[model samples]
Structures are given as structure tokens and as C-alpha cells.
Target: MNPRALRAAGPAILIVAAALTTIAALAYGGAADPLATGDPGPFVRWGLPMAKLLVNVSAAVMAGSLVLALFALKAGDREFDGALDVSSIGAAVFTVASGAVGFLTFLDSFNPELSAGPEFGAQLGRFLTEVELGRTWLMTMIAAAVVTILTFAVRSWTATLLTAILALVSLIPMATQGHSGELASHDATVTALSLHVVGAAVWLGGLVLLVVLRPVLDARRVPDVLRRYSSIALVAFVVVALSGFARTLSAISAWEQLATPYGGILCLKVAALVLMGLLGAWYRRLLIGRIDSANAARAAKAGRAFWTLIAVELAFMGIASGAAAALARTPPPATETPYSSTPAEVLTDEPLPPELTFDRWFTTWDVDLLWAFVAAAGIVFYLAGVIRMRRRGDRWPVYRTVLWVLGMLTLFWVTSGPVNAYQDYLFSLHMLGHMLLTMGIPLLLVPGAPITLALRAIEKRDDGTRGGREWIMWAVHSPFARVVTHPLVAAGIFVGSLWVFYFTDLFRWSLYDHLGHVWMVTHFLISGFLFVMSLTGIDPLPYRMPYPGRLVTLIAVMAMHAFFGVAMMMQSGLMVAEWFGAMGRTWGPTPMEDQYIGGGVAWSIGEIPTLITAIVVAVQWSRSDERQQRRSDRHADRTDDAELEAYNARLARIAERDEAADKAAR
Candidate 1:
């Protein structure tokens, strides 16, 4: 079909699907008895019966269509082929469904009986309370549809630019709307939700397109296309997984909830995700290898198997999305109750007025002395390793090993001392510890190329078949390798964990308990590693990004961080440790001092790493361009030389002809 016809089909199908879903939802709601209501539930009181049905059905349809689109992408067929047509239908259906859901919600806002529950009176009142979330999700689905359509028609740059704008627009409801009483009432939910929706769309949409449309494309170019998408998919998976985990942990409060029905559902979702990860690994290992070897039959077989696994994964993802919708309406477990403990209890029954303390690092003698020693030792070891390595060149034997050991020792010291001490107060010191462990330390260690160095060190110590050498290779080549490297999965984990910690009662719980601290520390380290690996060319992970694409990814991340910081600053209530008030640390130009500082960290200091990343990408791009230019210049010079030789021969032939004519005349 012509491009114009194809474009028309996309929007036209979407409009029809939306209209049908709206009609279906209205019919469904009308069929149910209006008074057939259950007990006044905490969340159900927030909306009308019809509104609820409409929203749920619309959400389901959108989510289901998203799954279809993801499967389509994975199918790997031609852009305008039958698979593409099917995927376009799915996109259109999701768009309409989302629109119907959003419109019904707006309509429900006008009904006086919608929020007539004893808990929260009036529909407007309840919606005002929960409008932020409604707006967030509604905006998200709409934006996803638009971006998906754009991806089919526009160039990557244009589509990406539009997607970014849409992402910003989707953040509005989250920022302005109040949270459910069960969850944190602060504005972090806005940032968290924004990340969640955008991450999910990019991940699911990319996969759908790849699955459905990849196969029908030019057969000879399939490997390159797959490789390109694989890299993108890996990043998308990482973002989705990290962000999802962050949101979950931030919302969940009590450890006991893990055994509850709500927690059980969450666990099931996680298990499904794990299974999906396994399927993805199989594809990378079996199918990708075959495609690389130009084995068309095996590649096709692997493709079919991959689609089956993706279909299963999508079903589970739908379950998870549905559960998420339910969870939004359900009160988080009782354990999530915020500020449950009295101020007196938190302050150890002290009747002292809160006082602000800054630059008090030296007050804690034990921590101070330990950190000092650690600093001194780290400096000494670092210098020693540098000197030794510089002298020995690439053959430097024990220096790299010594450096790695010293780094590990430093990490332990930082975590055990300052990290532990800060856990006691849950103050700025604790946040400092978090940054050190997650962002600062990882930055230093990753660039040191520890994995590569460790691999070489093992090879030197063993006969290559035994010890750590074999183990390193095994791990890199293992199924887990692809799971962690999947773009959607890893990104989900990285971004999700951050949301989970701050938004849930888990924040306070972690501050109160040792185990909570441990969990936080573990998650922080893991997430940091995954994020850095995705963005930076560090580990031997089987993914690489084109320069332009990497720049766009970096921009998207920066926008997210900036949005988070600004949103936090605008919040009226405290979102961090409540005991911050008890500790006198709450004093500043305003209560938002910490948030402002956080934003500063995100905006100013965050740019340092990003700048470094940009430079690296720029260097690579320039080097590639330089090589290409040199080749072109050499070829052009050769062509010019040949032309000059031809011209000279022609002149010589003319002269010979003239001489022959002169001889004949004589």
C-alpha cells in the first residue's frame, strides 16, 4: 500500500476501535445493577459505578492492545505487511479505549452520588483527591498512542521529540492531583507515575513492533535490524524493570504484606516477568546466534518460539497491569500507614525542641575516625596501584588486583561506617550514604573496568579452564546475562526501585530497622550498576547504542530527574523521614530545602556524569567519521589520478597523429 494509505489506515482504525470500546463499556456499565454495590471500600468510594467500569474496561483494552503491538514488533515482518496491519489495529484499539476511559472519568466527576460514600463525600471531592492518578494514566495512554502512530510515519528524531513533549504533558495530573489517603500524599507520586507510564509504553511498544514487523522486512538486512533493536530493547527492559521495582517498593510498607493477597499478586507478576526474561535470553542465545550465522531456517524457528514466549509474557504483563489498577484503588497494606509512631516515641521520649545541625560530621567520633582512616588508606593504595601500573604498562601484574581489593575494602568501609550510622537517624547523612554507595562508588568502580581486569587476572592465575576465568565466561554467556541486559527489564528495575523506596511506608521502615537498610543498600547498588551499564559502555554486555540514540536517551533521563526534583520542591508536606522534624534538620530557608538540594544534585551534579557520557559518545562518532572521511579522500585522489593519466594519453595520441600526417605530407 502507498504511504498515504497506510497512514490513513492507522488513525482511521484507531478512531473506530476507540468508538467501539466506548460503546462496549457504556453497555456493560448500564447492564449492571446500579445498586449492586459491595461494602463501602476505601478506594471504591472515589468514583461512580459506571465510571469505574468504564475506566477498568478502557484500561484493559489499552493494556491488551499494547501487548498486541509488542508482539507485532517481535514478529519482525515488513512495515506494511499483514503483521504490521494487525499491530496497527491493536494500537488504534488501545487509543480509543484509553480515550473512552478518560472521558467517562471526566463525566463521573460531575455526579454528586459518585462519591457519596461515608468515607469521602461527593464524586468531585473524591476525584479531587484521586484526580492526579486518573489524569496521569489517562494522559499516558493517549500519549503512547500518539507516539506509536508517529513512530510508524515520522523519522526517529521527530517521533522522539514529540514523545518527550507528550511525556511532559502527562506529568501534569500527577503533579496537581492529591494521592489516595492510603498512599503518600506528597508529589513524588507524580514523578513516580510519570516514570512508570512512559517506561512501560516505550518498552511494550518497542517489543510489539519488533515482534510483528521484523520478519517481513528485507531478509538480508534482518541481522543488523535485530541487533539494532536488541540494543534498544535491552535498555528499555532495564528502565521498565528498575522503574517498576522502585514504584513497588516505594508503595509497599510492611514485610508481612508479602504474604497477603495483594503481595501475592505482585509476586505472581514478578514470576511472570522472570519467565519472560528467560524467554528473552533464549532468543538472544539461540535465535540471535543463528541469525548472525545466516541460518534462515533456524532463525525463523527461534522467531516463532520467541513470539510464543512474548505472548505469554504479555498475558502476565496484562495481569500485572490489571493488578496495578486494582492496587491503585485498594489501600496499601495496613503496614503502609505513614507516621504511625508518635513523635515522642521516635525521639526516645525526649522533650527537647528541634534544632538544626549542619557541618557536624566530626561530632560522631567513631564514624569520623573510621572514615578518616579509610580515606588515608584508600589514597595510599590508589597511588601505589597507579605508580605500579604506570611503570609496568599493560603487563602490570599485581597492581590491578591490588586496586580492585582496595576498592572493595573502601566500599565496605563506607557502607559499614557512615551508611550504618546514618541509618540510625535517617537524616542527610543517610541520604549521603545512599548516594555514595549507589551513584558515586559505582561511577568510580565501573570506569576502573573491574570486570575486564578481573577476567584478565583470573586468566593469568589459572590454566584458563579453571578458577575465576571459567566462571566469568560462564556468567557472561549465561541466560541471566540476557535477562539483566534486556533494556525494558533493567530500566524497570533501576527506575522502579527508587520510586518504591520513597513513596511507600518502606522509607520510614527502612530508617527504623536494620534489615530495611540492608535491602535498600542492596537495591541501590544493583540498580546503580544496571543503570550505568545501560547508559555507559562499561561491561562486556552484548549491547551498543548509536550515538544519536544515546544522546536522546540521556536527554530523556535528564528530563525525568529534573521533573522529579521540581515536583518534590513544590510539595507542601514532607515526603522523607518524618523524624526529620524531630531531629531539627527540617530548618532551612523553607521546608523544601532538602528537595531543592536534591534537585540541585539532579540538575547540576547529575550533568557531570552525563557530560562525561556525551564526550565518550562524541569521541566515538568523530573517530568513525574521521575513518570514513579518510577512506573517501583516498578513493577520490585515486580517481583524480586516473583521469589525469587518461587526459595525458589522449594528448600524446593527438601529437602522434599529427606527426604521421606531417610525414605523409613530406
Candidate 2:
């Protein structure tokens, strides 16, 4: 390992050790005591502490292993690098094992008294027995071990197969776990826990792999690898964030909870994430440049900075994990009677029937007209600018202006009027608004190529010297782009936002209350935008997924939505206000039917656009690869022909000169 890397590892190791010690002490000491009660429940007495200990220790170990892997990948002797690889595999196993055991232990602790009926006890027993069965962790561990073996044997196919298997196993939890309804009820905590644990594994595990492999990779190959990993990371991030948020939202009842301990902790978690993002951005912008320049000193400095930021981020994640542990144990806001209002009282006393009675045409007309005009104007202006640029042949200002205007206009139209109104509705309307904002807006706005176009436009009007525009261009093109566009990270935000809002009593409360309604609309818009942008290729991302991998991700996402719909349909009672039900008109079917259809709509229709997108991406990638291959082949052939002709011409010239010299000698 590089001497600098070794030095940097010292502080990271110390931090991990300290955190583990703290966690162990806390776990053994027992749950934090309240003034009124010494012990809250059987779960608190044993399960919570054990879970916290295991999570904290495992996370710390994972952090250390990651640092080791990064060091080995970035530096060190060839033979010694295998040690780092093994360390990563070991870290993953320990992390998964500890998490599973901790969760099971919690369940056992909860039922220590065995006070429930025999049926309940039997079910709990069955669950405990199956803890290791059909687990993604087992699959992941075996896959990692195989990859390690393959690496040593130099069997690339084996390694690839193992990686593919691991990836598939990772997808299982997204399908079977983390669904909304399951999260709202306590029955699926284990499933939710497993899904999240696996997600973290994929994310942290990939980072470890990259860090270990980076040094040996060719310079040109590094960017491509990083890009691929970025895509995976983006997806993982989305799942983590979405699932986590869903769990939190399901636990909390109203906006008032935001002021309580649970809400305060949630806010802290968010702030930590934001800070982590900022640190990541700094690494991407400042450090990445040094690494790319191949300046050893600067690269080392950047590496240290990156490691420091990641460590801090990990620590915050630990706190979030701890908070989540607490949240799972707390009673959900929905279960608590905040104002002692009965369901009958709430349903009967409302002034309105809670149905949509307004004229549909008038409600939607103005927004529709505005969007139509905006779309037409955008198309015309873009075409005109394209034609003008074609005539001028490379004049960029006109095209840039057109692109910028189109982007701004699209953003404005989506954020205003009908789209906004749809976002406020109860069910289908809200989903419709979500689709437009996330799917439609990203499609249109991403293609505008706003940053690149703006930069070219600035360059075209250079006037005298480069100054502000140059700095802006530099910043945009810098490493900072990687941080924001990191696949796992971006995906976390997208998925986490969705999970948080709906799982909490917030979902029901948001529908019935005016302020909550506004909050929901805002979050839906922002989160939807983030989700689409993370997955799609409309914008230039520092990292990108291969065509095949992206297609699989789209499939996985569709599956998740479908499962979410199914879970919703299975709910025994109404989740939303009757008036706000499907089409703003409640039908004779049970609430479960409406939910089922809602899920079906989300699942079936969402795939149509995503599949269309995937096909387009495949075609585009194939064509691009083919064109590049053709160009390369042609260039190589031309070079060969030129070399042969030159050799022959030189031989003839030499013979002619030699003959003239012979004549002069005679």
C-alpha cells in the first residue's frame, strides 16, 4: 500500500474501533432508562440493545474492510492485494451474519414471555427457524466467495457468473420486501430489515470491490468501471432512501410528529445525508481532478480527503441505523388516538362528501392549454435554432439559447397549474401527476443538455478573455458531477423519499388535511423528478450503466411497483378518505379492490414508458457501438495501406540512387 494511504488508514481504523467500543458498551449495559420506567418491554430489555450492538459493530467492520480494500486496490503488491479482497468478502459476511442474528434475537426477545396464543407462538417459532432460509445474504456470501476463488484461479467466467448471481439475489428483497403495506404493519419488520441490510451490502460491498481493483485497472478502463459502479450505486441509493422513508412515514402519524423525538431523529438523519452529499461533491470536484491529472501528490491528497468524507458519512449512517432501530420498536401514529376521534365520527361529521364535485373540464383546461402552447413554442424555437446552426455550421450560441429556454419552460409548465393540481388529488390523479413530473419531465428536460449547451454558448461569445464563464464551465465539467450523479447515491434519495411519506400515518393524514396535502404534493414532485433523472440517460451523468444492466434495473423497478400495488390491495380497511378514492368517485367494491386496481395501474402502466425507454436506449447504444467499430476498422485499414505503399516507394528511390552512383563510378 502507498505510505500515504497507510497513514490515512490509521484515523479511519481508530474511528471504527471507537464506534464499536461505544456500541458494545451500550448494548451490554441495557436500553437507555427513562425516569418513569426502568424497563419498557421484553424487546427493549434484550432485542434493541443486541440489534444496536450488532449493527454498530458490523458497520464498523465494514468500514475498516472498505478502507483496506481501497488501499489494496489503489496501491500495494500484486500478491498482497488478495488479502484485501479476502478482507472485503469477510467484511460482507460478518456484516450480513451479524445483522440477521441481531434481528432474530430481537424477535426472540420480543416473545420471551411467550404470552401470546399457541398459534402466535408457533408462527414466531416458524419465522425464527426460517431466518437463514431463502435469505439473500446466504446467496451473496456464496457468490462473493466464488468470485474470490475465480480471481485467484484466473477464471473470468466464474467470476462474472458469481457477480451476476449476486446481483440477482440483491434484487430479490426489492421484490419480496419493502412493500408499503407490509411496512405499515409490524409483521414484515424482518423482511424490511433484510431488504435494507442487503441493500447496504450491495452499496458498501461494491465500493470495497472498486477500491481494491482500482490500482490494477488500466487508466482508460477506470472511468468505465467507475461509471458502471455509479449506476449500480444510484439504484441502490434510491432503494435505501425510498424504503427507509416509507418505514419512517408509516410510523409517524402527522406533521406534528415532526416536532417530537422521532421526527427530530428523522430530521437529523436527513441533515446527515445532506452533509454527506456535500462532502461527496467536494471529493468529486476537487480530488477527482488531481487523480485524473496523474499528479501523485495531489491524488494522494484527494484520496485522503475522499476517505475522510466517506468515514464521516458512515458514522452518520450508523446514527441513522440506530434511529431506525428505535423507530421500528415505537408504536405507529395511526395506532395511537391523537385526539380520541373515532372512525365513524370522522366519516360522518365532515361537511362535504369528500368527493370531487368540481367541473373536470374547467379544472384541467387552463393548465392543458398552457402546456400545449409551451410545447409548440419549444418545438418551433428548437427547430429554428437547429436550422440556423446548420446554415452557420457549428455556431453554437443559437442552439444553446434554444436548449436553455426549452429546459426552463418545461420546468415551469410542469411545476404549475394542472400538473400541480393532479399532484394534490387522492389517488389516481396524484399518481398521474407523479408520472408526468418524474417520467415526462425528465424525458423532455434531460435531453435539452442544459449545462453543455450553456457552456458552448458562453464560449462562442468569448469577447476578449475567459473569466466567469470559464470557471463555470470548469466547475460543471469537474469531478463534482460524479458525486451528484453517483448511481447508488441518487437512487437512495429517490427510493427513500417514496418509502418515508407513505408508510407513516402521513399517507392518510396527508390526504385528509390541507397542509399535509401541500406537503405531499411538494415531496411527490421533487422526489419524482429525482427518481427519473437518476435512472434515465437524458442528462450527462458521471456514471452510467450498461444497456443490459439498466434494462434489468427497469424491470426490477416495475416489479417493486407491482408488488406495492398487490400489498395495498390486500389491506383490510380504507387507507385514504372515501371522497379521495379512485377517480374521486367511490364504487361498490371494497377499499381493498380500489387499492388493488391502484396498484395494478401503477404497476402495469408504469412499465409501458419504462420499457419503451429501455428499448430506445438499447437501440441507441448498439448503433453507437457499431458506428465506432466501423470507423476504427476503416482507419486501421487505411493506415496499413499507407505504410506498405511508403515502404515500396522508399525501396525504388534507393535503387534509382544506387544505379546513378554506379554509372558515375564507371
Candidate 3:
């Protein structure tokens, strides 16, 4: 196919392939078949997934375009505007499709009679307002509508970035309401699905953006944009692959299940994804560089090959996308165990873990896929930065690297190990995890100076587009960052969060909602990091408290920390009685005893890190003083004690004046 014609027909090819595949998969899996009892009819059943397919594709286009625009295209350029226009169009479709899906979901779920009657309208209203699934779609629609407007209005770098964020967030509601939510491992599945959706969107939508931009881009600019996009796609590929694997694990328990209809469809999707990955590798290694060949014919030939491959890539993406939609409607092979009326199962959506034991503390592992990914990415990126610095003959500290790795590992353990496994059952374990997250992890990470390393390691981009380094620098110097990273403010948030989280419904929210749980973890980590940075960070901050002032702040926070723990210890009534108190635990201490133990953990174990931070501060203060003395000695050595001589001369002059005045008075 002619490259120009292929580029023009790219989206059409994708949509057609996706539509055809969806119909076939639905037929194979019997997802859109008439229900045994409360069938919403063939139209509603078929239309729903088709609408969902539109939602997925449009959302990808919206998010992926904005991201590529930010990273690859210069602001105020025609290509940048075109990208936003594409994103806006995608968002508009997303909004309409989300609404359609919402309505279809109501029909499919409640099978309400189609009528203009008040009763029908009332039922629809109730469904939209009261039902979890209904509310999710409603929220998604609203977010999509908002994104539609933002993408159209935003032309600047900052505005486009914010719009891109909102576009990504709109997918979360969909992620939360999917089949993943019904799984035994609800949190893991939800996290995996969310990551999968976003990653796939970026990968697919970025390709779409490149195709749309190809006709407009000059030959010389093609390779650079493609090169940047390939990097984005590469990262997206990793995320999609990992998250898809996780989702697969959650959905299919046995190898034999792979033979089932749902698993067969999954295999098809996996095959498409694998082919795309290979295509990505092929072009990235060979074709992308050739597209910029100085010889015009060579460049055009490479461009044609690249664009044709991209078209094929889009078709595969469509196949994967269609299979995903079908999988959502298709039941997984693993039979879900019916939840008993056990309080633990009722709250957590899973059976109670075996009773806690000393050995189990180390052996027990309920991995939080989200945090596991985060820790892995953190270590990988940090090491990558170190390597980059070393390659450039820049000397990055080995100790800093070690500390960062240790910090990330500790974070992984706190989030995914025994603490995470038992936290839902044991208050003590939760508190232990919290302390490590807020105090211990930050203590190690602050010394690593990741921000400082990144500044040095990431090559500055001269192009108008914002890359990783540009964005990082902007965030560090942003007004909000300045306020939050203030010594006093960071200290306040660090100490105050302890009281606010436990004493309020926020703790209960974290217990019930995976989103809330992630928010809690993020909040603690950031607040702790800021406080530690103010105290002993090697990274540059806008403001740093004087060493004495830092010590004072630390002491005050420590006092509050101890008092918060004591308050927890003294609680006559359990906090979030419906949650922590009603966990139906049998192996651990009584709820009250466990609560007391939790308080003890906060008062004792939590303070160990604080004391260590204090000791670090003290040692830093001594070193600072020693450095100042050495500087003074060096200055004196250079000036031959000029300052001391000046001081002595001034004293002698004062004495002489005083003696002369006394003699005149006598």
C-alpha cells in the first residue's frame, strides 16, 4: 500500500478490524447472546460492547495524542494543534460512548422497560444515582465531557499536560467498575486492569497520533518525532505486557482454562500484542534511523516502510482492543467462590487469611501489584539514571545508589509483604506499615537525592516540547511544590496526617477502596519525603530550615507523634469500629489489645526512625560546624590573620581613646 494512502486510511483500518473482531469474539464467547431470563434483547446486548469499543478507542486517542503532543511536538505548531484537535474529537466520542454505555448498562443490568412513563424515568434516575456500576459510568461520562472541553481549549504546555492527566483519570472509573472488581483478588485485578488500559491507550493512541502527523511532518523531522514516540511506546509496551500478564493470572487459574472460550480470546489478544511488540522492535532498530537518511530517495523509502508497518501495527492494536472488550463481557474460567457472611469477607471481598504467626510474618505475602510495579520502576529508573551519569563521565555517588535501592526494596516490602497481607486483619501490622512508609523509607530515600541525580543525568532538551527532564524541573519549581516542600509545612503535614487519617473516615475509606488505599500510601510517602528533605536531603530545596530550627521542628513533631500514639492507646472505643474492630480476627490479640499494640508500634517502633533522623541531623550539624571552621582557617591562612589583626587593632584604638578621655578629665 502507498504510504500516504495507508497513513490516511490507518484509523479506518483499525476501526474496521476492531469491529469485525468484536463481532466474531462475541459470537464465539456468547457474550452478547440472549440471557436465559432477563434478556435486554439483542440490540442492547450487541450495542453495549460496540459502544464500549468506541469508548476504549476514543479514550486511547485522547490520552495518547496529548501525551505525544507534550513529548514529541512543539507547542504552537500545526502538528501540536492537530494533535489536540484529534484528542478533542476523540474525547467528544468518548463522552457520547460513555453515556451510551451507561444507558446500555442500566438496560442490561436492570432490564427496565423502555418507555416515556414517569416510572421508567424514575427507575433510570435511581439507577444512575444509587447503583455503583451506574455511578461509575456516569462519572466516566462527566469526566469525558470535561476532557472534551479541556482538550479543545488548552493550547499551552501546562494546560495540555493537565488535560492529559484528566483524560487518564477518566479511565479510572471504568477500570474500577469492570469484571476485575468482581474477582477474588479485587485490588490486584483493579490495579492491573487500570495499568493495562492506560498503557495500551498510550501505545495505540501514540501510533494514531504519529499516523495523523505523518502527512504534515517534513522528512528531517520524521525520524526525531518517531524516535521520541518509539521511546514512549517502548515504555508503554512494558507496562501493557506486565499488566496484561497480571490480568491473565487473575482471570485464568489453570493452564487447561486456556482452552476455554474466554482464554482462547485472551490468547488472540496476546498474540496481537506480541506481534506489535516485534514490529515495534523492528522499526525502532532499523527503519526509524533510516527515515532520516540524507539521501532523499532513501529517506522516502524508509518512510514508506515505516508507515506501512505502522498501519499493520494499528490493525493488530485493533484486534487486541476488540478482544479486550469481548473479554470484559465474557466470564472468566475461574469460578468465583461465593462470599460467606464472614465479616472479613464481607468487608475485604476475599476470605480471611490464615492466622498470624511469627513465621507467617516473614512468609506471608499478599503482593500489592500497584506498589510492586512502582518499586520496580523506581529502582529501574534510578539505576538507569546512575548508568547514564557514569557513561558521561559524571561521578554519581555509589552510596546514594545503594540507599535508593534499599529504600525502594523497603517500600516494596512495606507495601507488598507481611504488613500488607495482615494489615486488613491486624491493626498493629497496619500501623507498622504506616510508620515505615512515612518515616523509615523517606529517611533512606532523602539521602539518595534522586531529584539531584535526575537533574544531572537527564540531558536537557532544547526543543519546545517538554520531556521527562523538563517536566521534572517544572514540577520542582512550581508554586505548589514550593509551598508543600516548605520546612514548616512539610513538618506540619507529616505530624498532622497521623491524627487526621486515624481519627477520621479516611482510614475507613482506605480499608474499603483500593483508590483510597493508594491515595493514603502516596500521601504518607510524599509528606514523609518532604519532611526528610527539609532535614537532611542532599537535593536542592527552595528553603531549608537552619539546623537548630530543624531540630526544634523534629522535637515538636516527635512530641505530637508520641501523643497521637498515646491517644490511640487510650481509646476506649475502637477507631472505625465497623472496619478494624469488626474484622472477625481470631488468631491475633483481641481488637482492643491489637489496637493498643498498634499504638505501641507507633510510639516505639515509629520513633526509632525519628531518633535516627535526629542523630543524622546532629551529626550533620557537627560536620557543618567543622566545615565552617576549616573555611575560617583557610581564609586566615590566605590573609595572614588579617581579620584577627583588625580585631586587635580596633580594641587597642578603643582603649587608647578611653585612656585619653580619662586623663583629660583628671
Candidate 4:
């Protein structure tokens, strides 16, 4: 296929492939089989999944195009504009597809009569207004519509990035709707599904956009673009593979269940995904370089091979999409028991954990896949940067690397180890995790100076496109960063969040909603990091407090922290009584007693990190003064003590004047 022909036929190929595969998969799996009672007919049963498949493909294109444009293409170029146009068109399709899915879902769910009458309209309205599934689709449709406009109108970097984020957020509603939220390990299921959807979209959509933009890309830029896209696809492959596996575990409990229809569809999806991954590795390793070879004949041959393989990859992606949609309709073998059996289960959707003991503290593990991924990525990227610098014979300190690695490890343990495992059941453990997230983690990470390392290690991009280094520099100097990193503002947020989060409904929200919990963790982590950065970070910042001022700020915040803990200790009524008070644990301290212990943990253990920070500030202060004195001595030595000579000459002149005045008086 030539570039022009591929550009003309790319989207058609993907859509046709997906549509045909979805129909075949649905028929084979009997996913669209008529219900024994109250069937919504073939149209609704079949149309729902078709619409859903369209939603998936369209969303991927929208998000993938924007992301690729941001990272790979230079701004103000035809290729960049073309990518955004593709994204806008994709968003429009996404909006329509989401609406179709919504209406079809209502039909499949309620089997409402097909009518134009007010009664039918009223029922439909109620579904959209009142039902959770209906609301989800409706929100998705609205968000997609908004994204469509934003993508079309915005061409600037910041605006387009925000639009892409909005586009990604639009997928969350869809991710939460499909069997994920009502299952065992609901939190993990939801997180995995969300990541899977986003990752798949980026991978699939970027490929489609590349095919479509082939004519627009300059011949010289092809290799670079291909390499960049290959990098993105590699990361997406990892995310999709891992999250898909996690989602699979949630659906199929036993290995033998692979013979079931649901499992069969899942297996097919897995095969397609794995095959696509292999194809990616092959091309990324071999074809990307050859496509831009010095030999014209070789370049032409490699280009032809690459484009042909892309068409094949699109077909495989279609198969995977079809199987996924079918699996959503098929009932899973692993259904969780009802949460109504116990108060703790009802509240958390999981049973109470084993009793909190010294041994359990070390042995218990409840991995949060999201944070684990974050920590892993952090460590990997940091190490890669350090390695890059080392290979170039640029010295990056070993201590910084060690601090960064240890910081990431600590973060993993705090979020995924025993603290996370029992935080919900025991107030004290939750407090312990909170302190670690806010203070302990930041203290370790701030000294690592990741920003400084990135600035020194990551290569600069001369192209208008933004890469890791560009983005890091932008973020560090961005106006919002300046505000947040200011010593006083950082201090205010650090101390103020403690009071505001605990006293308001925010704490309760965090206890109930996974989104809220994630937000709480992110907010506290960033706030603490900013505070520490102001005090002792080696990273460049807009402002830093004097050492004495830093100590004073720390002391003031410590006092407030202690006071807050004391208040918690003195509480007569339990906080979030409906949640913590209702957990029916057989072997733990009473709710009130646990709360008191939590207060003590916050007051005493939390303050230890603050004290350490204060000490660091004092140490830095002493070193700063010593450096100033050394500089002064070096200046005096270089000039033969010129300052002292000038002072002595002035004293001598004064004494001579005084003697002359005494002689005149005599």
C-alpha cells in the first residue's frame, strides 16, 4: 500500500475490521442471544455491543491522536493539525456512539416499549436521570461532546493537553459500568479496567493516526515519528497486558474455567493481544530503522512491509475489541458473595482483614496496583536517567540514586504493604500510612532531587514537540508550580490540609469513594513534597525560605499537628461513626481506643519526621554560614587582607589628626 492509499483507507479498514469481528464474536459466543423472558429483541441486544465497540475504537482514536501529536509531532505543522482533526472527528463519533450505547442499554436493561408517546419518553428520562448505568452513559456522551469541541478549537500545547485529559476522563464512566464495580476486589478491578481501556486506546488509536497521517509526514521525519510511536506502543502493551491479566483474575478464578465461553472469548482476546505485541517488538526492533535506511530501495521495501503489517495489526486489534465486548456481555464464573452479610463487608465490599498484630504488620500485603505501577515507573525512569548520564561520563551522585531508589521502595511499601492492607480496619494504621504518605515519603524523595537529575540527564529536544525534559522544565517553572512551591504557601497547605481534611466531610468521602481516596493520597503527597522542597530540596525552585524561617515554619506546623492530634484524642464521639464505628471486628481494640491510638501515632510518630526536617534545616544553616566565612577568607587572602589594611590606615589617620589638634592647643 502506498502512503496516499493507506491514508485514505486507514480508518475504513479499522472500522470495518472491528465491526465484522464484533458481529462474528457475538454470534459465536451467543452474547447477543435472546433472553428467555422479556427479550429486548435482536436490534437492542446486538446494537448495544456494536455501539460499545464503536465507543471503544472512537475513544482510542481521539485520545491516541492527541497524545501522539503532543509528544511526537511539532506544533504548527500540517501533521500536528491533521492529528488534531482526526482526534476531533473521533470525539464526535465517540459522542454519538456513547448516546447509542446509552439508549440501547436502557432497552436491554428495562425492555421498554418502542414508542414516541410521553409515557415512553418519561420512562427513558427517568432511566437517564435515576439509574446508575444510564447516568454513566449519559455523562460519557456529554463529556465526549465537550471533548469534540475542545479538540477542534484548541491548538496550543496546554489547551490540547487539557483537552486530551478531558477525553481520557470521559472513558472512566464507561470503565466503571462493566461488571467491575460490583465484583470481589472491586477497587482493583475498577483500577485495572480503567488502565486497560486507556492503554488500549492509546496503542490502537496512535497506529490508526499514523496510517492516516502518512501523507502529511515528511519523509525525513518518518523514522523519528515511528520510533516515538513505537516507544508509546511498548508502554501501552505493558499496561494493557498487566491490567488485562488482573481483570481476568477477577473474572475467572480457576485455570480450568478457561474452557468456559467467557474464558474462551478472553483467551481469544489474549491471543490477539500477545500476537500484536510480538508484531510490535519485531517492527520496533527491525523495521523502524530500515524504513529510513540510507539505501533508497531498502527504505521503500521496509516502508511497504511496515504499512502492510499495520493493516494486519489493525485486524488483530479488531479481533481483540470484538472479544472484549463479547466478554462484557457474558457472565463471569467468579461472582462475589453479597456484601449484606456483614457490616464491614457492606461498607468496604471486602471482609475484615486478619487481626492487626506485630507479625501481621510485616506479613500482610494488599497491593494497590496503581501505586505499585507508579512506584515502579518512578524507579525505572530515574535509574534510566542516571544510567544515561553515567554512559555519557556525566557524574550523577550515587547518594541521589540511592535516595531515589529507597524513596520509591518506601512508597511501594507504604501504599501496598501492611499499612494499606489494614488502614481501613484500624484507625491507627491509617494514621500511620497518612504520616508516611505526607511526611515520611517526602523526606526521602526531596533529597533525591529528581527534577535536578532530570534536568541534567534527559536530552533536550530541539523540535517544537515536548519530551520528558521539556515537560519537566515547564512543570517546574509553571505558574501553579511557583505558587505551590513557595515556602509560605507550601507551609500553609501542609499544615492546613491536616485540619481541613479531618474536620470536613472530605475524610468521610475518602473512606467511601475510591476516587476520593486516590485524591486524598495524591493531594497529601504533593503538598508534603512541595513543603519539603521549599525547605531542603536540591531541585531548582522559584523561592526558598531562610534556614531560620524554615525552622520556625516547621515548629509552627508541628504545634498545629500536635494540637490536631490532641483534639482527635479527646474526641468523645467517633469520627465518621457510620464507617469506623460499624466495622464488626472480632479481635481489635474498641473503635474509640483505636482512634485514641491513631491520635497518639499522629502526634508523636508523625512529629518525628518534622523534627528530623528541622534538624536538616539547622545543619544546612550551619553549612551555609561556614561557606560564607570561607568565601570571605578566600577573598581577603587573594587581596593581601586589603579590607583590614584599609581599616588600619583609617585608624592611623584619625590618631594623627588627634595629635595635630593637641599640638595646636598647646
lDDT of 3 at 148: 94
Q: What tens-digit string does per-residue lDDT give for candidate 2 at 1-666?
A: 342453355335433543453344334322333324333454444454444434433443343333323322222344224534444454455445544643454344343344567975665555545543324334433444443343344322223234434433433332232221122212223334444555554555555444444445555444434444454455455456555554555456688877764466556555654564565456555655565556777766765565555556556555544544444333333452334253423432222223343664235422322233345545654555555555767655454455446654654555444444444333554555555554555555555554444443333323221232454554545675566556555555545555566667787666554335446645654455444555654555567766676666667665665666566556566555453443333432444454555556566675565566566667867887999989877876979768667889999999999999999999
Using TM-score as the measure, what is the rank order of every candidate, best first?
A: 3, 4, 1, 2
Question: Which whole-number lDDT from 0 to 100 does residue 135 have in model 4?
Answer: 87
Provide the lDDT at 448 for model 3. Answer: 94
Model 4: residues with Cα > 4 Å off, grouped in runs: 179-185, 654-666
Alpha carbon deviation, residue 28, candidate 3 (Å): 1.4
lDDT of each: 0.49, 0.48, 0.89, 0.88
Candidate 2 off by > 4 Å: 1-125, 128-182, 185-203, 210-259, 294-296, 304-311, 330-353, 357-666
> Over 4 Å off in model 1, which ranges?
1-99, 103-153, 156-196, 251-256, 295-297, 338-666
lDDT of 2: 0.48
- What C-alpha lDDT, on a 0 to 100 scale, does residue 394 get in candidate 1? 49
- In candidate 3, what are the lDDT values of residues 522-559, reduced to their tens digit? 99999999999989997877777889998998899889
The digit string of per-residue lDDT tens for model 4 on 198-286 reads 99999999998999898878999999899999999999999999989988887899998888777788898999999999999999999
Candidate 4 Cα deviation (angstroms), residue 143: 1.3
